[model samples]
Target: MKKSKRAITPEDLTKIEVLSEPQFTKDGTSYTFVSTKINENNEYEANIHLQQLHEEKSTPWTYGKYNNSNLSFSPDGRQVVFQSNRSGTPQLWIMHTNGGEARQLTTFKHGASNPHWSPDGKYIIFTASLHEDDDVASQKELSKEEKQQLTEAKSQEPLVVSTLKYKSDAEGFHDDKKTQLVSYSLEGNTFTQLTKGDYHHLFQDISPNGKQILFTANLSDNADYELTNDLYLLDLHSNEIKKLNERSGYHQRAVFSPSGEKIACLGHEYDYAGATLTELYIFDLQSGERLCISNEWDLQLGDYIIGDMRLGASENGPVWSKDGEKIFFIATDRGSTGLYQVDLESNLEILHKNDSHVFGFSYHKETDKFIIGISSPTNPGDFYLFERGSELRQLTTTNKEFLQEVFIATPEELEVTTEDDWKIQGWLLKPYGFEEGKKYPFVLEIHGGPHMSYGQSFFHEMQLLAAKGYVVLYTNPRGSHGYGQEFVNACRSDYGGKDYEDLMAAVDYALDNYSFIDEDRLGVTGGSYGGFMTNWIVGHTNRFKAAVTQRSISNWLSFYGVSDIGYFFTKWELGHNLMEDPKKLWDFSPLKYAENIETPLLILHGEKDFRCPIEQGEQLFITLKHLRKEVEFVRFPDANHELSRSGNPKLRIARLEHICRWFEKYL
Candidate 1:
């Protein structure tokens, strides 16, 4: 090992600064972004920073232990409004551009978020969750003692369930509180509730003329069974609501043009359910016509590059040119994301495309420049200044000091041909402190989101494993995004079929090509869908000496009713529901092959993970123990499905240490 460099440790996450939510002022003279860091208390503290185009370093505009984000500049660019949790919940707060103490703007019981300024800057458009009986201005935050008393009283009351979607992993249990739009007037200092009822009005954008508002929600009579998020436009003057689409598809991320004459949309018709590729669309208000702008494009719109360092970075999606002739957006293509522009005639051209993850982007036509956030295998993330013709100059090096002290691994792209003649893409990292010729242990990592791809983004877990002397391998198999639409939908209804072969083929190709890989000492691990794959791998073969499955699914029968989205997700992905084809789901379940599992298995799960409940790990543990097989189980309290990505800082460290300890013991 070199004298100046040290291997990365789990605590290095505290030193890493996660930068996201990039935005430019109207004049393009200055920009603002959020930088998040883990404090000594093991909690996330994010603050907004401002920097001019020629400035060397950014100045912190806000500071505290509270989480601050969702910043928006007023029409005059003299004031900025943002949402903060300083008052125990997220509420709108505004401060002058010159910098001073920020003033709290809202005290609603449930708080306000996603603040946006109207064109005239008279009112700020935001959303807040409210029950039908709660008044927007009168229902305020309760005292600590009152909250405790209310909690005690409500604990004894039965949670009455009537809706099909009664719970969420984020919110825990069902309540009457639904998201609604409220306009806070800066001059009048009054709260005006724009929409209300049992549904949610997801605020998308306010018209450039300040007369209209665009949002999406399902107001259908049978909304319990409907999955559509139909686009709607609300006239602020008349308070009238109008639906834009025929209510056939799930549409969102809609924005109005600079002229306020039309709107751009990103959505899909649920052809492959959630696995369907997102297409772009345009709506003309003058002609009352709609056009699909990206009908011929096979790529998925928006950023899909998976990473762990992102925290509420603003991505300006479907931005129209100042003249309203073209729209700019980001798309994932072949394991990388890039910026692209499309005209009204469907002619598209790439503005920036490369082998890097463009996690966040902003465009300024006034100055013909853009600010983009890029990350690679070795870098965490940093913002860049890019003019149309000038070179992409680095603007911020948030991880410069951290990188100087720690060694970051650079992944080599792996190409493997599957059994079906299909190509699989992956990356391989060499173990730290390498010699000229030495065989080393290898560990394969599978990413969550059977739909989310493993791409050119920074992953702290993989880097830690490589630093600990194990060659790490991660891949994007079938059913992963960033490939074309058909490629992403290939693994549906055949979960353990071709996808398993693709992974095994990739491993075999890796072993054959890399002489430094020790064939006898192989370990495997994955989370969520990757967790299911890990379980399936152990049951199907004894090749891997050790295996770790995290937040996995053991039996689809129980998952069909237990998971938050299990009812429809099972049928959509597996082509079967609980009652219709229990046999098929059972056949594909890894628990069915428990008797064949010879590898030492480690099951890791979170107690609060509603998406993949802890019962999954329990089922596998009991089945394996009953069969006299080697097994272990680890359950994290109060952690959810996102435990690995955004869980409590201490628990995230513990999780990583457990993975390293297990692999070190066996591999």
Candidate 2:
């Protein structure tokens, strides 16, 4: 096994807090999760914990450290199965729910993940990928000359791959190819292949009766439309796999109703022009008929307005209650996603709403309680249990120890009107230890996915900036997701046009309203599309004092050819392909206007980022240096686009710290 490394600096340790995968036992007496525990020696260790509440006292049922998590309890609650990489590759591991005798379930050379217990508790289903030997053999199948070429290709490290259409920030490590489903039996010690071939199947959920499995996959004939993944039902008895949803749309988050009579899932039907919108649908198990339960107006998932039914940031799939009469889910169409319980019989009524992001949830029918996993811009991830509709009670405080030791700023929501008369949403984070009438530097942080929303989730960089005495501003501009499809598609072909205006409008609004914000000391930073926007912003305006772009797109023309998903994303997102119009790609590239940038810019990238590619960073870095502009580059090895979320925890922390260092020095 590759030895785990520790963060060299104390600042690095403090910045990265490891807490994820909160799961509950059947009786609701205990919970299991994975988190990093920092020892007194300052070394970080990954751990899995089984915490139980007894006599009003929380006791550690079982706690051990070795980089484990993604826990799921068995139906009987006798065992807890999870995935871990301690065996060199991520594989399935199981231990008694009470935390005894941990056993490795799968010894396959290929990695296995996302373990789900069967209802009868006899088997476990998980996703698996190709083995290293298979990878090598596949490459070896080519002719001698071709093999030599591939070997040479493997040996030669990635250069500034300028020939491609789209380049990811760090680029070229492992080609994330196919992932499939498999089932294993505990008694027989035998594994069965449930799903086969090149397509990927993820987020698997078993039917209540253990008769079938529901998952999302893109196995359609039109492989080009892989982005439009649909739900599929796999019959364990007949080994038959059938597509569930009919529309040439996207379907995901399939959950079986308690009675096994129906299935609730989020359906996204896509028309031409490429708009991704989600709607809640309940499919009758026997009749194959689906009922659309949400407002027809591009229903955003997550949290909703209680009475009037408005959408805010919903893209969350529906969750069935213990009795299955009520479907609990989070939708953002109304406000930031709070917990909402929709009565399936009443056509989905909103139950609870909050101005925070609620991602995971569980309904306990026995106690008539609901457990929700929520996060905000200030708090990362924590559990909240709701009983009888009284005030919600917080269960865990994973980051409380660190948060108490540090000064953190709270963000204020600002409703600003755009020139288009649209009221865009934004939040301003004042510096910690903030004083009135004191001017503070500010950083405009943009989110990627343009389709992805920045919810009330704990952001290390945001807090770090606030700790560094900089007011941070982040907003969901027009092109951002969580609003309806109309809002997301608004920036379709006009990438840097209106979306840029919305972001700028947010900054303008914050500056006008927040007296403590220093306009001259402003800086900007973002990743992916946000990175593209940051590149666009600095070139268009010298208003910001400095900027940092992480895993950004400098040149769209190159991105279309180099990155793995470049061919599709460029065409779908930009509405133009290199084959259609090369000049159009160049016109939108940030590198096109690199000559105009005067901002002291810092560029950070991963060495193995396939989404944005390292070339994007090198291109921008070289251009800035050539222009005699201030620039610094930090490259993290073996990291990807997801580095901010779940990459090497310490490196993730370093990335946040480095960005703060740059903004503090330049802004």
Candidate 3:
């Protein structure tokens, strides 16, 4: 039997298309979203538009030299407010719903984001961290005693602390840094601080009556607010605050039902024995009764545990129908994040099923329609409008034009069964100009989180690799989310064991099935956990010709003492402290296997990254260099762990280009 081949051409990689962020109005007949149209001047301009149903197009809202999305429509659908970086940092901007004179509402140096219009449409509230204390110099004033207290709290084992959902990345063991809840009145530019405190407030939801504010914070009685956070309510009238959940476990994503009598949210209040899987729960405000919403209690959901608010995972954060009869949300128990509707009267039922996952959504009360944002492993981010018995309409496609203009090869979804009979999901983006019988270089791209999933989304770096003529294969291994809880926790206390086998199996599957992939030209790359795996792969085998490790963990022992989440992450994932099991941590360190690495390697890191920290990368690079092996290191200054996402846009492009350049040079 002969083998079949897959190939593509350079001409297929440059067909760019244009689209916008889809925002539907209350009437359901019209929708609006942000779009960047390529002008004759060869630059992009941000525009807003309203398109009527069944119409090809209707209206365009034009501003100058900038692009914006994350639109929030008023309750009456008369005004829209969104965040824009047009003035440099992101600030809140407002424009009439029908499109008129656009006005800037916020003018802060540090910028403002996540603007949410009050239910009554009288004011707008959002998260702002622009105070002078966020500055580096101001933060350097912590006295020795304060520093000792912070360090001691962080090092304390089984430490007693208040709050439910605790421990944010980089914040360490103190809750001194806070995100202010600022509200801007529509009539006047006056901004008021609703709830003043020295704790973080995120994912705020106003009560149906607009008389109270519900949000998640870590401001319990404890001075060591570095622990978990819980949901709280602030009465706009009496100015009294009340705690909602009584459990010691993590509780977040709280929202009031349309009737205002009950609150629905998602939480993991019980201990999974240090596992990262969180399920959905609903709490009744009046009676203090709580119920688990999702039947898939063990199913892992969302991307990262940091701010894993259920708002994006669920159809709408405990959103109620206009009549308050049902709730809609996205569930991952079925293997993919599909939108599901739960009836308060009946059992939860699947409403809309798609291969892609749902992220964010907004409801239009007047028309009973909902706007949803969806993403898949193959597709980037796209918006869709879903109404009962109506065909789903794609509202905005921000990258379709760019993707088309680049005309890179689309990934082919692939699934492989592991040694344990675990069916793993993956995709392969074949190289451009590929020919069936001819072999080409292959790059095995790994994802971070160890708990994250690589779904269908337009990734610039991966696409650029395909454009540069290399087959890129990325997969969700054993510990990745989207799979149920057991699968997510599969890597717990066994980091480099089964997970490594899963990745190796994926590489083997690609090599065996793809006739055009050259085994001698194999390469590997990843960030965070992916970076750790990349390090692991090079140490364990010389099959790969080249490797790139970004923000990876080289030594678990050092990582525990250094990383912001080092204390909790190591203990939770490895089930051991350095003192309790130093050998276990060292045995898993990629630097421990430096002698086995025969491949050329590149080390990439962000100087300001506090998560994995740059030292981890330094350890690996130094080890490889001291051994007189092929190694190079690149660091981006003023960059953090999120250098790839939400980092400086220009630098992100540079990072992508540099990685491809490295692969082109060595692979």
Candidate 4:
């Protein structure tokens, strides 16, 4: 008899290592990345790791309690620059490739981040938050005492807001601080403010010749009312600025061509509002001609795939090949993310495709290879080396030991046809050590971003649910990204119409196909949009024995006024503003149909969640109680909308435990 492996526990998350942000050297001989894990203090601990193409082992370049990330290699590849919070605030730090003590570079009051090396490697460009009253001239003239007084005056707790977009979920209450572009010269050991204004400037990339820098900013007089971010170019020497794209749209991550003749960017015209698929575009520097390169590629460019992992990962670059004839980027398709290549001739191809999530990837032009960070149903995430014809080699074994000691369940890929003839993609995770004849309770999980898709990524919560002897099912409904524009836009205005049908169709397909699932023992749960759906499901049907809703929305009427992105999100998704049509908003609200709900409900919300807000949960809980329905509300102190993914480690574990306990009591 063989020793049985133990089921994965919530505590096992602390041992899981997540690797991302791969940066390759100019020569493509070596690369560096960040490896992050939860520390004993219940905080994320990230360090830089380096590996050579010819070597089989990877070594840690930096280690400490403080988080270090955004690794970038200097042009010469002799020094590495990264952002670290070891100094109490995030600042730029430089270390040798050979390994030694890292030297601190910037000591600004507000700190610096997003460091970009100039082509010549003589200067480092970065963005820093500066007070509204502070500027290069004012800072130089101010005495030490005056600076201290100004800092104290700005620190007062009172938040005076006059703009509609005054608060954000990530930054909290908006202050006077504005993010501005600045450059630091290594030769002179001096700093120069590049762009300044009341607007926020996001650094994109440096031109190949290093003569101009490309960035994006609103720069409009009434930025609060506008929903566009225009691309701009600034002359490094003359300080002259020029707008690259004249169209009114949101443009970001623009990279100049190797020859400095054109630029490629990721953005959309916003014709579909928030549900619009991101398209790729190329702009000619000389002729000022803009072409939508990916207009025909129905797929959404960049990563919108979601999992239970910590915030998944940020989007990678729209990197250009050395020859400038082709550009390589990431695209979310069906249930997976893949690397795609496109040419000027409108030719597009998927360079690498897998039934897994490619969260982050880097292309090494010189070596014609790739350093990709990927995750699947069983694997958390690791770095892999890929070439044209050679076999893909695993670069880092960050979680190999822990995986060998635990039992990991693999999800079975599924495809269900809806009553409307639309195909829905999904996955089913069987309980660990699943016996043939034993029927198990099933839980249907829904993803948050009604726009984001559930894919081939490792989800701790789903796996944990399966470990507790429940089969877990999740799917990409009509509005999911991996499909196409029509499928993604199908849910708009119809909220619970076809999208609801697609989810129910998925459940029907699962019950008919998977014999191990018990029909009577079914539960449903979700957060954000999924949370809204969970509420809708209970109100419309009694098939589910129990349901858990996390950071969800119950009322669109209140959501438009309370949520962070409510003002625009409600109109974008519901296709109706509160004042324009209150009846339409009320009809789509889940709270309006709460009287019909019969399934026991558990509501989980973060007190500090600005996106969905705790009020959404409160309204639902109060309504259910008024109707004498079985319901419970769990509120997490000091947590936000990201509580489940990137909240306090203890709180995340507690939330998971609560979900499991609630389902066990009913299912």
Best by lDDT: 1
Q: Residue 168 CA error for candidate 3 (Å)?
A: 8.0
**Ranking of all predicted structures according to TM-score, beginning with the best and ending with the worst:** 1, 4, 2, 3
lDDT tens readout by residue for model 2, 409-508: 6678878799999778877887766677789898999988767777666666676677677888888888776677778789988889999999999999
Angstrom error of the Cα, residue 315, model 1: value is 0.8
Which digits, one per residue and each the tens of the lDDT, describe model 3 over residues 403-448? 4444545679899899999998988987766667888899998888
For model 2, what is the alpha-carbon lDDT of residue 60? 49
lDDT of 1 by residue, 55-92 (tens): 88999999989799999999889999999998887899
List the candidate 1 regions with Cα displacement exceeding 4 Å.
Answer: 1-4
TM-scores, one per candidate = 0.98, 0.85, 0.83, 0.96
Candidate 4, residues 1-667: lDDT per residue as tens digits? 1228889888887888887788787778878888888899989888877788788778888888978988778898888888998877788999988778999988777778999899899999999899866653323334457668876987885668888988888777787788999888999888889988889999999999999999999999989888899999999889999988877899998999999999999999898888899989999999999999887778899988787674334447699998999998888998999888899877998877888888888888877788888888899888888898877888887788999998888899999988779999999999988988889999999998799989998999999998999999999999889899998988999999999988899999999999999999999999999999999999899999999999999999999998889998999999998999999999999999999999999999999999999999999999999999999999999899988888888999999999999999999
Candidate 3, number of clashes? 29
Instruction: Give each model's whole-structure lDDT.
Output: 0.89, 0.72, 0.71, 0.88
Q: Which candidate is the best by TM-score?
A: 1
